[model samples]
Target: MPRTRIHNMNISLDGYAAGEHVTFDAPIGGAERLFDWFDGRVIHGVDRVDAPVTLDRAVISLWSQGIGVEIMGRRKFGPQTGEWPDDGWRGWWGDEPPFHTPVFVMSHYPHPSIDFPNGTSFHFVDAPPHEVLRLAQEAADGRDVRIGGGPSTVRQFLQADLIDFMHLVIVPITLGRGVSLWEGLAGIEDRFTVETVTSPSGLTHQFWNKNGHD
Candidate 1:
């Protein structure tokens, strides 16, 4: 059975996964600074190449390692709101979208599925986490499903107790306000065994895995 996982999500010290005031210019919200730990490595989904095999690179590489389908909030897909303006907006990812698998964008408004030149195809759905997961799993064909998120989406899955594994990088900074991952997840740690490793870049990599599973 394929698992539901979250990989390489950067969080602020105050537990914000995304900053406030998200716009086309600022994708990750005000928490854009949280990703300074990239260290010039080639982003796996976007660049599709590895830098040296350092911890940052090693962990970043896993973002695309074994995932088949991706389920993300509409905000993660883009900064669009209301009805989609036009077909012109494919995504923030340009022609060669990084995700080579089927990607599901959870949205309130409906839109026809968009397939890019690359292997990525975006399907817009207005469904809850479990229903969305079922659809993604069917499309994945037994491969794992990744929850590519904007905090709110991830929190929904967490609240549903549906995530099997999660990799969160806690950058050493604080965002006073934003969408937080831990806001309503009071005892989320009890769902998985927590392990911590500090990267050379001062980011703490926290792995949350279910007991007796990877």
Candidate 2:
């Protein structure tokens, strides 16, 4: 069976994953409450040799090195601060982003194409969500295609039942108000199955697989 890794490009806590409105200023809501989840790497500049990210460093490293192709929403790609004027704008990650594979961006506004110098190629698609996933999957070849998302995008795909597996590392913080995983998801009781869990930094890494089977 073919599977995709639906994970976050940026992460937060259960509150953000389970919140109401995910915005730039409030990207990860209630994340402060998740210090128990991230393994203690809570965005501090402090560097420790023996210490990992202290913030779900395991999951972060997996995200950085595991996938080949990635799909993201335009809002997640641009400044979570303001509206984008044209297609000429690239992502905020700067010249040499960590992503070097093909990235598919979903957007309504028709903008010109972009080619980054870091071996990363950006493509905009107005096609249906499944179609976009299909294209990205194809581009990924053997490696998994990661679903990089903002809350809204993840919700859309989740509603469509397209996600296969996900690793949620709940950071311990709270935005108080911001975007959530779903507006009407109601519950995921029947959709996902917990595979494994690890605890660190007051944070717990919840690994989930789609229903019925792995």
Candidate 3:
């Protein structure tokens, strides 16, 4: 069966997924102090990230290796030209994002298709979580589907208990305040079984799987 998973989700010790104020300059919470966890080595599968690709590049390629499409929130996808009052910012990935498969961004806004230098193509959807998941599964073919994040979207799928499995890296430092990833986790016990833990350096990795996505 095709599974929906959220992997390597980084969060702060104080429960902040991102810093309080974010601009292009401060995308991942100061990009240094708030994200010291990022510099740590990432182990993909049984091997560490030894590829020549950037971390973001590896994130897309490695995670989707056997997965369906990737899903992101409107905020994560950024604003399109003539699409927002503020400065028009496309995805941070520039012309060649690593995702070769069709990418789905969940939002109310729609723009013409974004064709990247690589075969990667992005599609904007006004659909809900379930609808997007269905489309992602198809795009994934028989592979698994992945829900990539920016806090709010993760909360949506986690709230509905639509996720199948997860891999988390609990970093060492703490953000006094910022966007939290584990908030609104009130009813997940009804659908998930939290299991397994690994201590790697200062970071702790945890895994969880759904009882079933019925």
Candidate 4:
């Protein structure tokens, strides 16, 4: 069965996922250290030169596997807010985005969809989490739908109990003040079968699968 999943969600030890402020200059804000161990090439199943296959890379490589569509908040798409300005901002990604599938960007302000040559299409939508998931699932065409988040988006899906699988990377650091992933998500582990694997690089990868889900 098709599933709703989240992949490569990095969070601080204090449960913060992103930094306090996101701007066009600093997209990740103050939480840049959280992704120190990340290698974007591995998401496409590629390893670094002269580097052996590590556990962290092996796990992170699973990010784009079988993912047909993605649902993400507006912040994850760009630094714009409210009504989008005519900046011609496609996204943080350049001409080609890593997600070579339909991407539904959640925003209250509607805008025409943007398509890239690499098969990464960005569709703007204004709806609740569940409603957006429905649209994403339909666009998925039987493949899994990935929740591409910046903490707030993932928290909304988790609160609505709409996520089926998640790959959460917990980094050992404290942001002190930033966007948190676990806020108001008390006892969320009870709904999923949780497992953890600690890498030698000090990154703990937590896999959460909803109960009765494969």
Give me candidate 3's TM-score against the actual structure: 0.81
Regions of model 4 farther than 4 Å from truth: 40-42, 46-50
Q: TM-scores for all candidates?
A: 0.93, 0.76, 0.81, 0.95
- Going through the candidates in the order shown, the clash numbers are 0, 31, 3, 0
Q: Mark the regions of model 1 whose C-alpha exceeds 4 Å error after superposition.
A: 39-42, 45-51, 212-214
lDDT of 1 by residue, 78-173 (tens): 887899888578888878888888999999898999997778999999989999999999999889999999899999999999999999999898
The lDDT for every candidate, in the order shown, is 0.86, 0.64, 0.69, 0.89
List the lowest-lDDT window of 10 residues for candidate 3.
52-61
lDDT of 2 by residue, 4-64 (tens): 7775333454345533433445333334333344343322133332464444554555664
Pairs with steric clashes in candidate 1: none
- Model 3 error, position 28 (Å): 2.1
Model 3 per-residue lDDT tens digits across residues 94-146: 66675666789887766666777676777888888998998888878898877
True-structure lDDT of candidate 4: 0.89
The collision pairs in model 4 are none
Writing each residue's lDDT as its tens digit, candidate 4 over 1-214 gives 9999998899988888998788988788777888876754536664532377778887888888898999999999988878999899999989979899999999999899999999999999999999999999999999999998989999999999999999999988887989999999999999999999899989999999999865
